[model samples]
Target chain A: MNAIEIKNLVKTYKGGVKALKGVDLCVAQGDFFALLGANGAGKTTLIGILTGLVNKTGGQVKIFGNDIDVDFEGAKKSIGVVPQEFNFHMFERVQDIVVNQAGYFGIDDSIAVRDSEGILKRVGLWEKRRAIARTLSGGMKRRLMIARGLIHHPRMLILDEPTAGVDVELRHGMWEYLRHINAQGTTILLTTHYLEEVEQMCRNCAIIKEGEIVLLDNVRHLLTRMPQDTYRVTLKERISLEKAQAFNAVKVDDHTLDIEIKKREELNEVILRLAQSGFVITDFHPKGNRLEKLFLEIVSK
Target chain B: MKREYYIALKTILRKETTRILRIWTQTLLPPLITQTLYFVIFGKFIGSQVRSINGIGYMAFIVPGLVMMAVISSAYGNVVASFYGAKFQRNIEEILVSPTPDWVVITGYVLGGIVRGVLVGVLVFAVSLCFAHPMVTHAWAVVLFTLLSSILFSLAALINGIFARNFDEVAFFQNFILTPLIYLGGVFYSIHSLPKVWQEISLYNPLVYMVNGFRYGFFGFSDVDPGVCLLILLGLTVVLTCINLFLFKKGIGLKN
Candidate 1:
């Protein structure tokens, strides 16, 4: 069964802003899905419609077989959303925010209290349960939102830019936790600006541009479609500019070269040539976000 | 109501009650302090100088009106501030995204208002008793009018919170619209004291009926017929309820 199914979804705001344009998408149960789009590309709007936060102009949406227009309460019962912004009560303690959200879903207080402890701890916020929400740092606030979203234990979870401003260490931690939940049988639909997150966490992704889906496929397949791979390679010794140019490498510095490898075999061949020229390779890594390169490629088109 | 909606309703009420008691200075004490001053200045100082209305002492005559005023303000203030705060902080999305139906949301908030409004009303009435031994001709009318008026104002306040877009708009409706209506609703004096034309116009103010109906409970005398007042209150209550339910259904001033 599909976790979410959207057929011909459309949303046009006042003053003629077409936020969404007849978008069709689906995510199967227990799958980790990513919806990638630039700002104002209608990613949030589509989520809003599914969550009943925004009225849809026209379309059909079903959550776990419950039609949004016909059985909204049933559809809503199966899903939880952690919005892009912090929307919980700032004056309340961290635990209260999560427990109260459970209450909104009709969970008993006793059950919510019991559930929040586990959820908060899972999000690494059990120690901050008594602290006021506004007092927590931005990352903690984001975690608190995640805790609240999970308190009801819905079958499907939607997170929008969950780690937008988070530091690298915390971002990795979030990625690990999300992976853990997806493995535990909770389907996740994530939208993030961090293409690295998509590469690491999402199994399937759809790139949305101008309110339309431009590409949809397996994450691995999408990466393979990139015609070239850019790498920043560091060397133990400097190589002459003439030798570097011969291999079409940009001399970032005497000891560093920026090279674009067109094929997997080409990378091996280039390394062999550099080694023969007495330029020892010290370290190597992708120059930038590989998925970001493809994302820019698709959206800009 | 479903079991879940009932649970959600209780949750909303519990949260609201906690807030009222937690911030007693803002929600409870201000009305307590304000009403005490009304009993002191209006009933003691200025009241002594004025003659009795309808053969009742001025101090005793204004008791019911003052109590109703507190209920109106406290109930209206509670819903608008709390709900508007939710909207401003976007925390209202907490309930909006839930499975709780629109009626449950409306009931939860209006009940919260009634809780604060009636609590303040009771406190003010107790304070009035210390100054004057106001007669109670019909105890049921006192309780009935209090509930009806609180519910009406609370429904009205929820509408205000819905239409309000910013903090300034919240205060604007309370100051410019509600305050004028309550004061001119015959709180300080009887509608009988106004000129013939003004008395006719005063009947158009819904609060005049509310204040007089409540006074009818205490002194057994009123400027408007109690039966007519009851019908008007009930009718307005239904109208305000319909309007509020419609807004919630349409997600007016709430969803984009």
Candidate 2:
């Protein structure tokens, strides 16, 4: 069975603001599925529904084939959520926050306390265990949230923009920790605006726009589906726009021309034509698929 | 079903008690100070001129009313502020998503409010001893009435917290509705001393019955039967508790 399944999910706020129109998604167990979208794109809304934070307007959600509404307790036990906002009690210490979360899952104090220490240490927060949550920095607080979410050893972990506002080093560190956990048989569902993070971490990807799923496929396959390839040709001499236009290329500047080639063979043909025109090609390279392009393509359509 | 509910209830109650204990200065001190002033200004200075009320000295007569007044306000204020603070900080989502049931959440917060209320009431009672010789004529009745009244107000506060959109909304209900009811509910004088029309109207206020019953426990005297007061308090608790639980289940203010 899939780890998490959402079908025909819909959410509309009180003011008739339809945040989620209809979103259908399926994530297999042990898959690091990244749900990519811009701000206000319903990624958080979807997480909220799955975690039971937001009530669904209409639809069905299941965890391991157990209906969310009918078997909510069982579904909740399998899912852990680290929300975008820092939501821990300000007065609660790091250790207490983690252990209390375990207690909420019906785990006794002895086991909860032991697991709390281990999880806090795993997230590099053990030394600061007694510090109040409000005293932690933004990055450290995010790590604390991760530790609290994992205290119960849930089967699935859902992270919403976990790396936002985090330094690159810490972001990478979080990715490594999350990867280790994912490798240990915990399915991960991540929603992040950072395209590079998605590219580096996710095996499968889904992009949502305006409350609807625009694309859902393997990350590698999605990257290959770019309609246009951008190639930068660095000329030995500044070429005139008139001359560059003759070869059906857009002159980005006097020395650089961004050319669109239909096929690999067309690349050599363009270079030969440029050479025949007495224009020396200093460097030539094709730009790989990027999230900016993917986002524009999906949102614009 | 029973086991889960029991566990959730126990945890919530424990957490609430801990919160009050952790912040006794804020939760337990203000009311003790206020009651002291009330005893000095009203019981000592003002009661010197006024005759005995309802066959009891003015100072002893108003003791139960003052105690009930403290319990009601503190009980309501504790839950409204604590629960709404959780909402404001977005920490309520932790419990909202947990395996705990909706009623369990409601009961837990209500129980917290009751603890604060009873604690404040105890503090005020201790302070009142300095002004007048207030005796508990029936220990069981005093305990019963105190617990019941605290629960009633606590449930009301939970409902207020759930429906409140901001801190202003939380304060609005307490400042306007709760405070007025507490002061007008025969805290300073017996309702019988009021005009005939006002006496009939005071019966509509729920706090009046609570004060009268609480006074009955203190002095073995009351304008109304103690059984009637108990029934009214229990009824209010059941009705408000059901409303709070329903609001929680529907995710009324929290989900939005």
Candidate 3:
């Protein structure tokens, strides 16, 4: 069974702002799914609806085959969410926050405390267990949030922009921790603007644009769907616009031009033409299809 | 459902109690200072000339009223501020998403407010002994009325907190509605001293029953029957609690 199923989910806020327009999604059990979108692309709204924070205007959401509205308690017991914003109690200690979350799930104090300490240690926050949430750094706080979410050992975890303000080193560390958790059979649904992280971590991907799912497929399959190939050519001398245009290339900068080649043989022809024009090609490389490029291509249309 | 509700309620109440105790400088000390000033100004200076009305000393006549006032204000203030602060920080989402029932959330916050209210009331009662020798004419009535009033106001505060849009809104309700009701509830004087028209109007104010019932506990005398006071308080609590539970279930102010 799928860990989460969202079908025709719609959310329209007050004042005629339609945040989500019938989004349909299904996350298979134990799959690492990346939900990608631009700012205000309904990523947060979708998360809110799935977690029962935002009221759905219409549609159905199911977790573990249980309808969210009909079996809310059952669905919620299997899911945990780490929100995009730092939404923890500032005055609460790290240990207290995690244990309290467990308590909310009906875990007794002894079990909750044991689980909380282990999760905190796994997140490298055990030493700061007694420190207030506000006193922790942004990265540490995010880790604390992750630990709090995992305190009850939920089957599925949803992370919304978990690395938004985190430093690069901490972001990498978080990815490792999340990957380890995912490896242990916990399904992860993540939303992030960081394309590189999604490309590296998620096996499946969904891109949302204007409250609709623009694309949803295996991560590798989506990358392979790009028809045009991008080549970054470093020129010894800046070329004229007309000269560059003659070879079907666009000048990216003073000494670099991006050429889109449809056929692999066309690359040789373009380089030869550039060489004949006395333009020295210092370096040339093909740019792999990145999520940013795919996003631009899909959304711009 | 029962298990999760019980655990959530216990956790929320514990957290709130810890918050009040942790911020003793703000929550506990301020009220103590305020009550001491009331004793100095109203009890010693003002009561020196005023005679006892109901066979109790002037200072003793107002002690229960003042204690109830403190309890009501603090009970309402504590929950309104704490719960609104949780909402403002967005941490309330953690509780909302849990398996705990909506009524459990409402009851948890209401219990937290009552704990703070009753604690402050007890402390103020202890401090009042320094000024006047007041006897508890009916121990069970005093305790019962105190607990009922605390629960009633705490539930009221929880509703206020849930509906409050921001910190200013939380303070606005307490300042505008709650404080005025406390003062106008005959906290300082008897309704008999007022004109017939004003006295009739005072009977409509709910806080008047709370104060009069509480005073009756301490002195065995009241402007209204003790039974009437208990009935009014119990009725108000049931009605307010139902409204709060309904609001929580509907996610009225929380969906935003």
- Best by the lDDT measure: 1
lDDT of 1 at B108: 90
lDDT by residue (A1-301, candidate 3, tens digit) is 8998989988899898999899999999999999988899999999888787888889999999999889988999998999998898998998999989988888888899988878988899999999989999888999998998898899999999999989999999999999999999999999998888888899998999989998999998887777777899999998788877887888888898898877435677878888998999999997754777888788788
- Residue B24's lDDT within candidate 2 is 84
Instruction: Decide which is better by TM-score, 1 or 2.
Output: 1
Clash pairs (backbone) in predicted model 2: none
Candidate that would win on TM-score:
1
Kindly report the TM-score of the first chain in candidate 1. 0.98
lDDT (Cα, tens digit) per residue for candidate 2, span B1-256? 5655665577677767878888888888888888889999999999888999757899988899999999988888889888998889988888877777787787788788888888888888888888888888988888898889888888888888888888899989988999888888999998888999998888989999999899988989887788998899889888998888788778888885
* Residues A221-243 of candidate 2: C-alpha lDDT, one tens digit per residue: 87767666778899989889898
Clashes in each model (backbone N, CA, C under 3 Å)? 0, 0, 0
Off by over 4 Å in 2: A227-289, B1-7
Report iRMS values in order. 0.6, 1.7, 1.1
lDDT of each: 0.91, 0.86, 0.88
- The clash number for model 2 is 0
